[model samples]
Target chain A: MTKKNKSALSEHTGISSPEITSSNAIETLKAKRKARIDTNTLVSSILNKNIAALSRAITLVESENHKHLEQANTIIKACLPHANKSIRIGITGVPGVGKSTFIEAFGKHLTSQGKRIAILAIDPTSSITKGSILGDKTRMETLAKDENAFIRPSASGTSLGGVARKTRESIILCEAAGFDVILIETLGVGQSETTVHSMIDFFLLLKLAGAGDELQGIKRGIIEMADAIAINKADGENLKQAKLAKVEFNRALHLYPPKPSQWSPKVMLCSALQNEGIKDIWKLILEYKTKTTENNYFETNRTKQNKFWLIQTIENELKRSFFNKKEIKEALEAQLKLIETNKTTPFAAADYLLSLNKSLQ
Target chain B: MTKKNKSALSEHTGISSPEITSSNAIETLKAKRKARIDTNTLVSSILNKNIAALSRAITLVESENHKHLEQANTIIKACLPHANKSIRIGITGVPGVGKSTFIEAFGKHLTSQGKRIAILAIDPTSSITKGSILGDKTRMETLAKDENAFIRPSASGTSLGGVARKTRESIILCEAAGFDVILIETLGVGQSETTVHSMIDFFLLLKLAGAGDELQGIKRGIIEMADAIAINKADGENLKQAKLAKVEFNRALHLYPPKPSQWSPKVMLCSALQNEGIKDIWKLILEYKTKTTENNYFETNRTKQNKFWLIQTIENELKRSFFNKKEIKEALEAQLKLIETNKTTPFAAADYLLSLNKSLQ
Candidate 1:
């Protein structure tokens, strides 16, 4: 059997099957044909709200093969009519901000409220080491095992936004499966949180009380983008500081002027470890939803995010394509070599590369 | 007289002549014209290596009047031929890194060796209040008094980068005024260091001996870009800790593979206040010049930097023009309002704005 057909059969069973042995090519070919038909049935099933088929479709979408994106796109398009029903929330915090613990408690809370939750984790590939912890499932074991909860770790990838694109597409799959809430969790390492914020309806930033760095004007810049800021670990002695932080954040939030939505940003203290403020957080999110939906901010924010992604995607593609040409590549290296040797300047080299690429094209 | 001629007369003499009174329309115009002519002559004299003219040209470049950019650009272009001769270095650190003392001692050493020097200070601007310290010249008293040295404090401006761009252009003006070396000092606050690095030939990052946060990868990213990491405040008691910090930095530097130029980044210790190791730092830079010049890295690096600026300029212009359109402005504001009110998603809003702009164009 062909490699494509063999993989097709493996994709049929909702597993990232690592091994494929086609000793009986004829039988394997027949099975592959059956798998292809099954995939179509699975796509339809997902669209019809079949949870198992929805899981299978997401696995297919995460595949690295070119054929998988095509198949995933097809499945997503088929499921589109039934998708987009869920409220997607993105939560980001520094490493020890109780992201997984909070998510588990939050997922359970949503399930108790008759809402099926899907959680997707986004992890960035370290540019130099090319290693990722890929520890999403391990961190949220309870949520992963819960019947009403769906959890997926990030697929190892090149760009943070690349991982986000797949997760975004997978969100459509989950929503089609009748999941009413989707929660995306990302660590505040690097710029991945920005990517996460672009894909979600509301962005929540969790901060530790006293250990916050003063120079990190992140609170100022990010607070403008966020729907809410929660000072985590706010239970015991930290409660006073947390209150102080909330007040400070409220002041900072006020400094931003009234948002265009005419909604004031919310800041609250929480003990994610104690699960004390999780419900209140949820209530605040609901408030955010009701207010934004009533004022049309929810849909407008999502639309703006989509446009941001489209432009970003196009620009990245243009840069990659322009740099990937053979002549341009050779000239760039040659120019860098010259730069290294003190014979030319970086700006001159860049100009040379631009002109070379233009001429080649 | 035209507005150009009035400015010329005002520039040659510090005080405005009574005949150039502000009341008479034509005389006022002539006075403006005289000031302009005086400024132009001053700019020309500065272009021809007059120190005062160079300083005034920089002041004009930093002015709010839109017409100053035209004159500034003209002055910069005229001085371009005399520029690119110096080893432009950017030194940055947080407050209390002994920046003023270091620059004074370093400037003294360079000037003592018969190397004319120019120091441009880029002070941080308060985002909310727009307040700036703007007092580096007073701090570097010795260097300020030295005939061989020129010290200019931060120009009033919009951004750190804005200040840097104007300073970079001013570096050309200073170089034309016969300065052989230009040192730009920036505040070591987050991305500001990186911004300064992007504009210079060599970048130096200064840190204290007892910084606990150094290991959390705060310094690692910038370490890769540094030509040298100098542990300052390395006195008697701080000696051991400084050595330890140097060792730690060396380890971190090792993680970064050799630069494209194949230059091995160096880490050293210094007591800038005590005037220790100042000459060695200059020696290292001299060695860098010798090595890179011999290997052609020096010229190529400058060329590449210019190319980078060109592309950056083009990209900024494209974005500016896109936003400049009246129709695009209306659509964007409308879409942003929708996003705020939840009527549309950010993605959809961006898409709508882009399409509207395209159609309108």
Candidate 2:
């Protein structure tokens, strides 16, 4: 009847597709909505110790989208009260120093003690190598598989400051989700270590004994910042050399004045692959925590770190806003040329540029 | 015209005050006005190699008055084209390291060769100690008396950034005054060394031979930054220890990777008090200048330093403007407390404060 009645111009449907609005599709839609949970539900779920929710929140924090920034801030602010409960440990070393193996073993030791752990990273060079530090989850198979362990790769971006900010926020989320130990791993070769050091309670620098028994790249500033240095691969034939390296580092560590925290940095030997000395390293960290806590350095250091981030965030944003402006970018190059040619002093150029920016504002 | 007549309402003036606009007083006023020269006159007089004008210009550069900032900027910009013609050397040592003796000896050596010299200082701790590095020009008595040398104390300010900026601007004034060599002296024990290092072509660390031979404070980052380490007080009874220190510093210097300058840092034994090895130290600096110039690192490094100052100035000014705001000051304290109580995340608080700043702008 429809074919006959619907002559040339008439339009008619033969049958409505039943599966278009089926119960499974509705349930699937509901699931999709559940998966894309809003900030409040995400916060609640994270507080409820949901790993999926925590992961999603971190992804939101690491996102590059401007729209996600608001949601990320909302989630992070909601989680702030639950944060700052964990001891953030920063572990760093050169690429071949067995960082992954060491971290895996170290993290496993923590989980075995019934401690929930989260590992994050801020590889300053990750923007190029895309995070050689923890880019490969397979590197820490046992740890990643543990229900109590959450491993996050470095936040991929061009600026170390941006990546650092992301990782810092992620630490808050991890702590909010009841992680007792937050391990931040970074490459010791760059500016990231300083950033990692500022955000962490204990900084552990991993080193390897050279063939001549000298430590590699003593990295003066990083070593000065370290709470403890562990000579990795201190097993088998490397034991004697490792001991020598430890002594050398011990002497080098003495070169720095007492830290503001008044805690003397220590040097120890460790074999990550052989799982030797891992316990001793952890014990040293525990000892550090105990002493620093007793002396009130732990809480005071946290307060200092809090204030540092507050100022650092403001300064970074201020510069970012100033430099990201199209007019400022063009004017900056011209001003630099002026400086190079000695036509303008740096301060005068800065003043001129700032005046330009003020107009822009 | 007497007092009785004035009392009677005659309004007669007493005999005119004879000294009121006398030729001698008028000439004195003229001299005072001449001493407080304008920026153009300051620049021209400095370019003419007048020490008095150079000193006045530097004083203007270091002035804390807001109005002086503009005048100082004008003088610096005018002097800039005449700058970059001299080698800027930074000399630093701990308080007890015989810094004054070494600098005086080194400076005398330069002046003896008919090379005019200018010494500036940036003691970061100066605001408290009022510049212990070069606070008293009497410390460099002979050099200060030398016709070919000029010495200025550290610019006094609470912020190292402010002091650094003032010293940096004064470098232009000194260079314009036809100084053949500029020596920037800073205390090695604090952050001033880094500030001085960033502003100079050559960084010389003055070390002392200790009671034993072990190098004092091996000073990792500074040692890495040094172009040469001169073990001062290396004569008489300390010669053997100084020899040992030289060897030790030489070994320690090798621990650092090659610098971008491509010139290896050297360690030498010197006795400034005895005037021993002063010529050799000067020769070493000449060699460094020659090598770096040939490699183009000299020019490129200056270019990099120029850019660093440009960005650093803008960033510093941005923070200064923001934090100095009355609203920002109050909001910052409130935000800090909120952060302490975990009522807000740093980045979120940063956004809120930044937005607050934006609205004011």
Candidate 3:
């Protein structure tokens, strides 16, 4: 099919548009002719560190089309052996915490050290915005212009799970494309922070100084997930308050039960705007990486995260299938009504609903 | 069938022996004839505050026997209208934190105020020990002897879900049995704290004075869930440290995001041994109850909890059914092996496995 006709077919069939392939496939022949270009072409290109091919492969991974799924799977499987070679770091902070500026500074520092960086995001709210908050490249102008830096915004308009799964797959493609550092950014609100935390080697929480409101909007659980917290915008007059906030955060952290990682979470001060303390932040991350790697927590955590994602994927798929059943959907509404009225206990209602589905037997 | 014959039949069928009704049914008539006595009898007896009947009803709720499930469901449904009339409190602490002593004192105080208190525990670890820590009533000598108090140990040897479901049902029965206060105790070690925290109207965390180890073994998440924290052993030489600890705890708690309950979590010093601050703790609970009730948080929270449990029960049942599938089980084992060997991505393996299951289709 012509590229135009292929996309028309895709649209008709509800497949997401294959952005890069369209141009070339249009200049090519029929549908059967396209099969001649195997997933190996994509795999070889990604392995050769071709950015366009890497981006296209990520698009395939993110596509909801069942048609592209098999090809995406093939490409990801081929890339797997080359993955896990990079350091995956998760960065999160509330809006207005200068996350983009911090990333630009951090990315520049790493690239100066001859490190290739790939930045991905897991923004649950992107669905509402219809585009990621970081979709605008101007936010991180310096890093966006750097050849060694690859900055991809959050995949918009998808469930957190969907976004997380795609981003995780994209990380593999990025690593296979020869990136040495993966920076996964997430908005501090909602469950995205936890999602990002699970997939990364090190988790950094960015906070503002002089905001007793610091812990106000962020969950204590999220704070506890941090491997280190950096008090952002620590330049000029904010310096003193940032140091004090650092002390307070350190004290608060001490009151927590030690993490299973056996590495104590550290608190630091940084000024992304002034490009101050950026190197120290990177140093802290390197220190953590070295310590956890020595204790084997770094590798073990990745393995555990793999197992966790496996179970999580199974559960999500199971829930989707069960809830998608026409009978279950109807029965669940009735059972929820019964529960809301307090006429039946939740356990009994669950039993009744399960009984309605013979497939469960 | 005769009582002896019925029990023999039960043994043959691998059914658990009916502890309370066997003899009466044996003296009366056949197995089917005894079931005709109805769950109403259990409900009415519980409504009249018959302690023995209440205990038997709880046992029915706790039973793993599929035969007793319907009866338990019916009894719980009958008791639903009378439930939620009492304050349900969850108490947790590490083993040496004097939880039982504190509870005994707390129970005595409530009864002294003309309140009838029922203490129930959900200890998942009790099964491993083969005896509940609270199973020894001699530990709470004063409360055990108090006529207005009813103390029951954890139901041993069941999954956390099973135990939590039973204890939740027991709370309904206790409230229907005219108990104005329901105290749910759980060891601070595991997921039981989160379970207990969910069912109760208020959660109280017990701590020790001089132990910087206060937060050592307990999860910070659990601490965040607390409505109040009481530093125990606040007597004699420990008084100064207790006061200091209380202040420190207060400051630590202040750093936490405000709870949805809008009641700031209070930290106080209490000597369960000396009975100091016991009344004040009760007053704190009363104040919390008043504030939350005034804001309608009490009712809204209960509703939210009901919905939460409803969804949790459904998810648990769905997982149980899915994992219990023979084909899925075998496939999962194979897939996990592939995962461990890094042959397939977890998402791909999950997709392949889900495709293998007809039910998922």
Candidate 1's C-alpha runs over 4 A off are A1-173, A180-361, B1-44, B123-136, B215-220, B323-333
Top of the candidates by DockQ? 2
Per-candidate Cα lDDT values, in order, are 0.72, 0.85, 0.85
Give the worst 10-residue stretch by lDDT in candidate 3 chain A.
A211-220
User: Global lDDT for candidate 2?
Assistant: 0.85
TM-scores of chain A in all candidate models:
0.83, 0.87, 0.87
lDDT of 2 at A17: 71
Compute DockQ for each candidate against the true complex: 0.11, 0.54, 0.43
lDDT tens readout by residue for model 2, A1-361: 3546757767666677767677888998886576457777999999998999999999999999976877888788889888889999999888788999999999999999999999998885765765456778999999999999999888888888788889999999999999999999987677788899889999998889873323234443677778998999999898998898888888877766798777899999988899989999888888998999999999888878878888898999999999999999999999999877767777888888999999998
Tens digit per residue, CA lDDT, model 1, B100-144: 888888999999999999888665473224444326367778888
The TM-scores of all predictions, comma-separated, are: 0.58, 0.87, 0.84
How do all the candidates rank in terms of TM-score, highest first?
Answer: 2, 3, 1
- Could you give candidate 2's per-residue lDDT for residues B1-361 as a string of tens digits? 6545545557666577676667888997886576456767888999999999999888888888876776777777778888989999999877788888988998999988989999888876765665346768888899889989998888888888889998898888899999989999887767777888889999998888763323333433677789998998988888998898788778877777899999999998888899999999999999999999999999889888878888998999999999999999999999999877768777788888999999998
Candidate 3, B137-224: lDDT as tens digits? 9999989999789998888655798788888888998998999999999988888888888899999999987676534433347768
Candidate 3: clashing residue pairs, number: 3
Runs in model 3 deviating more than 4 A are A1-29, A32-38, A207-297, A359-361, B1-29, B38-40, B213-219, B237-269, B283-294, B359-361
Q: Which interface RMSD values do the candidates have, in the order shown?
A: 6.9, 2.0, 2.8
